[model samples]
Target: MASHSFQTVFAVPMTCGGCAKSVSDSLYKLDGINKVEANVKDQVVSVEGTAAPSAIVEAIQATGKDAILRGSGSSDSAAVSILESFFEPDARANQETPDDGVTRDVRGLARMVQVSPTSTLIDLTVHGVAPGSYRATIRQTGDLKDGAASTGGIWSDQGAGDGSGPRGLLGSFTVGPDGRGSAYINNPFQIWEAIGRAMVVSRQDESAGPLKNDPDTVVGVIARSAGVWDNDKSVCSCTGKTLWEERKDEVERGML
Candidate 1:
């Protein structure tokens, strides 16, 4: 593996050694991949490299098998945010909708890993959204009481800004006509500093200043996620569903 490279674990359904071999061989063709280990007995594939986790999952899925990211980096070095729209919270005040339902609110997912003490890698993916450029920023607070508006101003680890500093910008990505977008960003920030903060992905242009009440915006709280070998449950204790079963539901909802 390259210097500062981290390992990522994925749960893939493998029936035999051949299945494992096929998966490993496919991963070896990808750039930045230093090592690939596939275990049929455990139906798990572990990779150590500088490649984006999203790309790793894509390569594994291309092998005719579904792959779910079990973990990444190490304990305390990884985080995740499930970005969802809060456009009509009052209209659906009493309605409960599953993420995979026809009216799913999930718009994107962000996976963050601290590669160095001063740097982090963010693998961001968005689906079922408008086709346009989106700017992502870390908000000062995790409050979502009024959608993105309630999240406050942009967060800057380099001290406060006069409401228009670039330090708070985490960079931007463009969603294609397919209503999907993906970006592997290398930002100068640690994962721990972002925990409990709010992440806003807004369709509004950055030149327009901080987005206030942008209906096309999606918001979510940054939370600590499992690291390599930190998660091992085969089935969700709360949902009573296997890992693959849950993956299927996510894919069906355009989360792939």
Candidate 2:
């Protein structure tokens, strides 16, 4: 893999050694990266290697932490592409698992505007989430056809954002006093293959207070692309004669 000596810095809120380890472990696994350093005292991570600033930031996010670009050694020489995603909330009918102590007052939407044969752009908007740190991740689905209404169901990390570190690590987000936040990421995944899968916004495990923690950090679902909904050929096949087609046929001969 080609590498650059670009050094990028980010401000992250790390509470202890474990949090720093999580950030390092997730970031070191990416290609083109050589070194990862996190200073808990400074609440910052300085990365040195040949990875794009955006990709490096994303890798750090997979660990349930947020990475913000401070400065890059290469300046503006890097080019990044962004694809849009479908945004929505999780299924609400299941309720298979209790939320533990997570608040459900939040509503969020995710969108992947476009995708190539193997990659996509993930954009998100969150409102009403308690102001703090949260994780956004994509998970393997058990049987849910649509992620938008999932109350509780089977979920496994889809591996990594681009098969490199972790899928659930779409990136970390923070809600402000207004209880809103937003994030954008470029990830590696096939949009079509991800349709039946699920994406969730979860509270950081360490951040969970008084309430016991469970997998229910889940907040909302990620929307699926338009193609996923249009796959059923029987819905609008465009081949059969419709009332409009028949009416036109009759009108041609004044049979109406």
Candidate 3:
């Protein structure tokens, strides 16, 4: 079966912990509702599990309160968010050959999207490539080759299930007369799993072996939950924290 994990947020009015408990109890009783948390300070309730958005909204209404679908997604902010990253210059994430020592360049754009509860899609648009066929892969780190940070590497070709099996291929594209094209793959993994990784396009002939060591290949970032951070003040009282507070922790811990 396909993954059914989903997250839905509702605007619920609560005056105290008792109100929160009431809302939580009502939502928790519903089938497929894995986690139901209420925040009285934010006047919102966040539900995570396999339940549908409409059903979740209805369940919140059953508590004799109003429920608005403020957010519906898979994990965190990426559940319904679209993220984008760009390829680097030094990393062989591109295909460039010099003509009489006049070296050309490749430009790339990587997009990560959560199309459903259990699946995410990686879309790539690459330009300035040599006129030929090429393959793309998602790696563990978004760092470049000999980049200022740690050098980059690929986890597997198992992004869209069309490459090398199990570890499916992300997808392939052929450079056109304009030296650019687009490709996309629907990955079985969640958006969170790939949001912080690297996406690299390689030569079709295995001439570059693995993308990590390919001098012609470049490494670009795969950012997660790119948007939806506007005026978002939702908080967890149990942790006494909001997303901003958590980010502060990451910054202090050097995890961001």
TM-score of every model versus the real structure: 0.87, 0.39, 0.44
lDDT per residue as tens, model 2, 134-157: 777665552223232332332334
lDDT (10s digit) by residue, model 1, range 1-256: 2347899999999999999999999999999999999998888999999998889988998999989899999899999998888776454544554233325377889999988876788888888778888889888899876668788787865733234465558877898998889888877777888999999998876466756654568888999999999999999999999887888787665565
State the displacement of the C-alpha of residue 32, model 3, in Å, after optimal TM-score superposition: 29
lDDT of 3 by residue, 1-256 (tens): 1145555566677899998998899878877778887889988788877555545555776878766445555335353211122234453445453123322233555545465644764445655556677777666575543331243444663444444453434657687877666664556676666655666676635444443333335445565443222335557567878655654553343221
Candidate 3 or 1, higher TM-score: 1
Which portions of model 1 show Cα errors greater than 4 Å?
1-3, 89-104, 159-166, 206-215, 252-254
List the candidate 2 regions with Cα displacement exceeding 4 Å: 1-106, 142-163, 206-223, 227-256
Least accurate 10 contiguous residues by lDDT in model 2: 77-86
Error of 1 at 246 (Å): 2.5
Full candidate order by TM-score, most accurate first = 1, 3, 2
For model 2 the TM-score comes to 0.39
Task: Give the TM-score (vs. native) of candidate 3.
Answer: 0.44
Separate clash counts for every candidate = 0, 24, 13
lDDT of 3 at 50: 59
